[model samples]
Target chain A: MAETYPKETSNTVNRYKHQDPSIPVPVVLPMIGQIGHYPSDQQPHCYLHGYVSSRLMNLAASPPGIPLCVAATKLDGFVLTLTPNTHNYNYRSAILHGHGTVVDDESEKLWAMQLVTNSVVPARYEHTRVPPDNAEMASTRILKFRIESASGKVREGGPEDERKDRRREDVLAEVWTGVIPMYERLEEPVGGPYNRVGEVPGHVRRFVDGENARRWTYAVEAARKAAPIKRVKREDEG
Target chain B: MAETYPKETSNTVNRYKHQDPSIPVPVVLPMIGQIGHYPSDQQPHCYLHGYVSSRLMNLAASPPGIPLCVAATKLDGFVLTLTPNTHNYNYRSAILHGHGTVVDDESEKLWAMQLVTNSVVPARYEHTRVPPDNAEMASTRILKFRIESASGKVREGGPEDERKDRRREDVLAEVWTGVIPMYERLEEPVGGPYNRVGEVPGHVRRFVDGENARRWTYAVEAARKAAPIKRVKREDEG
Candidate 1:
């Protein structure tokens, strides 16, 4: 399937952080992000939620939202090879480029709140205290970024080594080439200080169990898949 | 202990992407990265590896190099609360602002290659084919980013709810407040197509077992800790 979004297990977003408008200072904020389409929109826009600094809020509140880019990534496995230069990772990454604006419509904001809450755990919105009071609603801030352009890439399968390394019997015998599967594993729920509920609810339990199984399977499967066409190795710096 | 760098398990880097020189297009590339201090440097800088587009390489090749931001984050858990607004995540995030340049010194490049290789799995470089041949070395590219300014944040502990929701007996009684501990889990290694080694090497096995244990412990511990001071809920939208 051509997946346009990261798996359900991923709900995090990273946006470029600019310290000052005059100086192009590159920084990124790791925040909660969900993709949703409001009633009035034809296409889905990204909704960002988290501790947004006041400067970013001000930038977004102006005419057009701050120029924003959203990136999400999930590491599947470590692809080990006969040589250090050939080592790679099985991963999925997506980036969205757009201008972000603060959402002012109350109903649209309310809808986004519900959409994001349930995105983590199904039916979580209805299960929680309904209709946030005026003060609660007033304090919340969500940035809506209508994606202008987007792209993604997925890297998978076992290691592919150079002809020199592959031909060397000594190297092949000494080096253990393979993939170390990696995934996000969710463990048992630990109740908080004031939790009164007797047992974990059905929604939470189901989310935990379902996600664990899916993430594990994906990582292992990616590790065993066929290798992609070889290209020049790109080192962070050489 | 205060960690200036991300844990050993994390070797990935995310840099802001700009498509056009004139138009600021926000983009991010997920690539392999490591931190190392060359013998000549006063302090450590970030060493980046992996497939870097020609445009980015050209930008970095310039006199000052490209303005770069590197971000790293690890999700510890999902903090569930009595109300949707109070939901949170236990995470560790770091951002570094710097200028990236192409490494011209072959000796420094070779040292970095070893520094990054061993970072993922201790002593992995020695285990692999020694001294990448001239062809192999020539094809590889790594980016050296001198650190200018950096910052990081860590959020742990279980959820904290509002007084209004905490006071409502019905809400407290129904809601299951807790944290679903999450971590990057490394599974059994699967040997590749051309592997001749009979057993998984000592280094790979130790890495998988050691990381799985450390990551799981950290996540569960974070989930049970005390929550931070109450703050206004930052919604994706209000």
Candidate 2:
């Protein structure tokens, strides 16, 4: 079943909507690349996976009305050089900003807490006991910060900085420079219902195949490079 | 022969000097920690290691400098829950403000690039070939930004959101809530000066040992835990 809400436009980020009841504005779709997913309805509560450290929350809240916003930036690459000053890096990130509030209402609180868990790992809520009734859960202060706005920035490239060191090209230091691309995979659901049956679903099949395909392609490429006669090796190996 | 400068007490970070220009900045005694060294040598310079992106340099430059600066933050840990939104993460980063400059002086430019390299991998400068040339290095719009003011922030902790959470402690989904610490090592120095005959230097040895020790200690503990049972099994087999 699906319930449709108005798609987030530019306006939502500019203005605060659910301030009083303090409902945590859901996380905007994550910055997932080609195969990554903003998986739908993974848990009973339709919530996205995210959490802010209590300390950061408190620090970000120091400005009174202005909430602490977090922006996660990842350095994907480095542009190196002959001169010391020229080196730089390329990166990606998630920016989360808003005045978060503590989950208080029993029902909404239950959902928020459960959603935090399930959003991170689908169905984790089911594996454990319900949260609110427990004393440990009752004691910790989890505030629901109303997300105000956020944006993403990414960059990838080679030693574009070497232009100034024109003469240094032929002398290109032997420092290794290239992408050893990182792959992200959420392994087959372990210890959950799938583990008991010892069967993974078709949906999970893609995640597995994608990983293997990536590995196999790399392996084949390595073999081809190693072969004495490249084309001859290809035929012999095939 | 050795040249010694009078030790300045007031500004510890700025006073420390690199005794050897050949060693990577990180390996040079004074450059070890977060503190820096940029004393007034015959030619004055600054100890610049980590900071913001190149845009920072432009922010502080030329005609009517821009009042605003950009920031880059990173969230490293991914807290995957049953839900999608809570798949959070932990991380480390630097957000800086101010204008950076392009070093024009040949000597200054050379050392600046060296500092950046050492910042990335300690002792990387000596192991790696010397900086290329102006053209190759020029591609990196290396702007030297004088950090008039800046700060670094770090966060660490388990999912405390569970405090306000409703779930009980023991059964609290039994979700993994701890750090997956990040460790990195420089590949055993390959093609270096004395690459064939030399054993790793004491400094490099100390560096690897410090981090690798942490990693292997856990393995040793794990092996110990299973040793008795393994011994008994071997005897039975015999």
Question: What does the lDDT read for residue A97 in candidate 1?
Answer: 60
Across residues A36-119, which tens digit of lDDT does each residue of candidate 2 receive? 212332322122223334433343344422232333443432333333444444344443333434444566655555555544
Poorest lDDT segment (10 consecutive residues) of candidate 1 chain B: B1-10
Evaluated on CA atoms against the true complex, candidate 2 attains a DockQ of 0.06
Isolated chain A: TM-score per model?
Answer: 0.85, 0.46
lDDT of 2 by residue, B16-120 (tens): 232232211110001111223333333222334333234334433553232221233334333323222233343333422332344445665556656656765
Against the true structure, candidate 1 reaches a TM-score of: 0.86
Q: Model 1: per-residue lDDT, tens digit, A123-191? A: 889988888889888899888887765666778889998887799998888999999999999999999
Off by over 4 Å in 1: A1-22, A226-238, B1-21, B229-238
Local error of candidate 1 at A128, Å?
1.2
Candidate 1 residues B1-238, lDDT tens each?
A: 0111111111222222323333354446776789898989888889988766666777778877777777788889988888778888888877665678888899998999998899888889999987988887888888998766566678888888888788999888998999999999998999999999999988888999899999999999999886653232211110
Tell me the lDDT of candidate 1.
0.76
Model 1 residue A148 distance off true place after TM-score fit, in angstroms: 1.3
- List the candidate 2 regions with Cα displacement exceeding 4 Å: A1-65, A75-90, A96-105, A134-149, A156-169, A172-176, A180-238, B1-35, B39-112, B126-238
